[model samples]
Target: MGVKIGLTGGIGSGKSTVAGFWQEAGAALIDTDAIARQLSGPDGAAMAAIAAEFGSTMLTPDGALNRSAMRELAFSDATAKQRLEAILHPMIGARARCQAEAAQAAGMQWIVFDVPLLVESGHWRERVDRVLVLDCSEQTQMARVSARPGWTSSSAASVLAAQASRAQRRACADAVIYNDGLDLAALREHVLTLCAQWRRCK
Candidate 1:
């Protein structure tokens, strides 16, 4: 496909901000979270497998997967998270590949995969031409999450704990975008620069 960049970061680390900048730079973006949500929707292929494995309780009254329930289950049980990933990750990856192929065929300059769990999954490393990490200190992350309308520190901590450590993510990243104290403008500039560099490289 085109020059595919894997954009990732820990929870509340501005991964979405980086992705938005990539979009502004004219890169085709495929967010795995969005694809996962679609695959968990009513009539989606993953719904049947999930129902078969976890029963109807995992589904809502509208026949869609209960996202809140799944979130809680995943956080409380490691096996449950693995089981859900096993059913949805492949489908998400397939859709991402299809999008990347289409973008390449259309002569797009780059494709950005906004995958928050890229390091955790490990399977995506080889699929990407480069790995871009949007990084901030854990303290900054906690502050950002705590300041959100409905977020609590404990919940934020749980989400952070589920992902790869900050040190580990930084160690594996091909490029880093430090967003600790920067505003949106600065973040955009960093992403734009990286996008330019990546485009030139390929």
Candidate 2:
């Protein structure tokens, strides 16, 4: 297998941007968040289970998971969140492993498993060769997320509060990219440098 990197960061920490840089540099990127989104879309693998657990009210008119409604429920109810994870995590893990195996078979030098909750999940550390964390301050996180459409400071705060703290994420990181004030070009340069380092290590 190639160098497997578990890329993670807090919400709005620009983790996706970093992952994009690595993807463009030829790393096979398997994003768990994107997979989860697909699995909750219309006719998704997790949809029937989600509907069964939360009923039709948790689904949209088109039969997709109503993310907004589900998010509200998950945040307010711990059991609801656990139930959702129970349904989705196994599916996500299986898909991710398959993708990684395919990437290794295709002769890829790097496989970047971009997971939002890499540290919180606890099991991800054993699956990946390295943990790459994108770091930024709470204020930066709030500012970035608040600028998005339909997101308020309170909403961003709540989401941030639910994720692992910056300190905890850093503790698990084999490499950290501090993106608090860096521009896109600088971030790309950082990623490029890291990619070279990972290639050398491999």
Candidate 3:
């Protein structure tokens, strides 16, 4: 089997940017968030379960997940969040496993599982060979998120508060990539160097 690396970071920590670099370096990527989104899209695998659990209010006119509504509900109700996760996590995990197996069979040297909640999930550590965390300060995270359209400082702070703390994520990390204050080129260079080292280790 290929080396399975769990890639994670809190919101706006540049985890996606690092994952993109790994992809450029030939690592097969399996993003759980992307899979979850796909599974909640129109006529998606998890839609029926979601609609059943949360009712049609959680679905869009196109029969896809109403993400905004669900987000609101999830933040407002812990039981609702758990119910939604119960419906989606298993499906996402199964699909991710299948895709990882396929990549292994196809002779991929490395398979990066890009999961936003890797530390919080508590199961990914046992599934992957290594955990790579993109580290940044809370202020940096807030700034990055707030800069995005439709996001304010309060919204960014809310997200940051919901996720695992930096210390918590760092404790679980097998490797850490500090992304604060780095430009794209600098970050890419750092990732390239790390990829080289990982490849050599493999």
* 1-202: candidate 2 lDDT, tens digit per residue: 6889999999999989999999999999999999998899999999999999999999999889987788788778889978998999999999999899999999998899999999988899999999999999999999999999877888788889888999999999999999988989999999999889877877
- Ranking under TM-score, best-scoring first? 2, 3, 1
Tell me which of candidates 1 and 2 scores higher on TM-score: 2
RMSD of each: 1.7, 1.0, 1.2
Q: Is candidate 2 or candidate 3 better by TM-score?
A: 2
Q: Give the winner by TM-score.
A: 2
Q: Judging by lDDT against the true structure, name the best candidate.
A: 2
Please give, for residues 128-197, the per-residue lDDT of candidate 3 as tens digits.
9999999998999988999998778877786788789999999998889899999999999998998899
In candidate 1, the residue pairs with backbone N, CA or C atoms under 3 Å apart (3 or more residues apart, or in different chains) clash, namely: none
Overall lDDT per candidate, in order of appearance: 0.87, 0.92, 0.91
Q: What is the TM-score (0 to 1) of candidate 1?
A: 0.92
List runs of model 2 lying over 4 Å from the truth: none
Worst 10 residues of 2 by lDDT: 67-76
lDDT of 3: 0.91
Runs of candidate 3 with Cα error greater than 4 angstroms are none
User: Candidates 1 and 3: which is better by TM-score?
Assistant: 3
Q: What is the TM-score of each candidate against the true structure?
A: 0.92, 0.97, 0.95
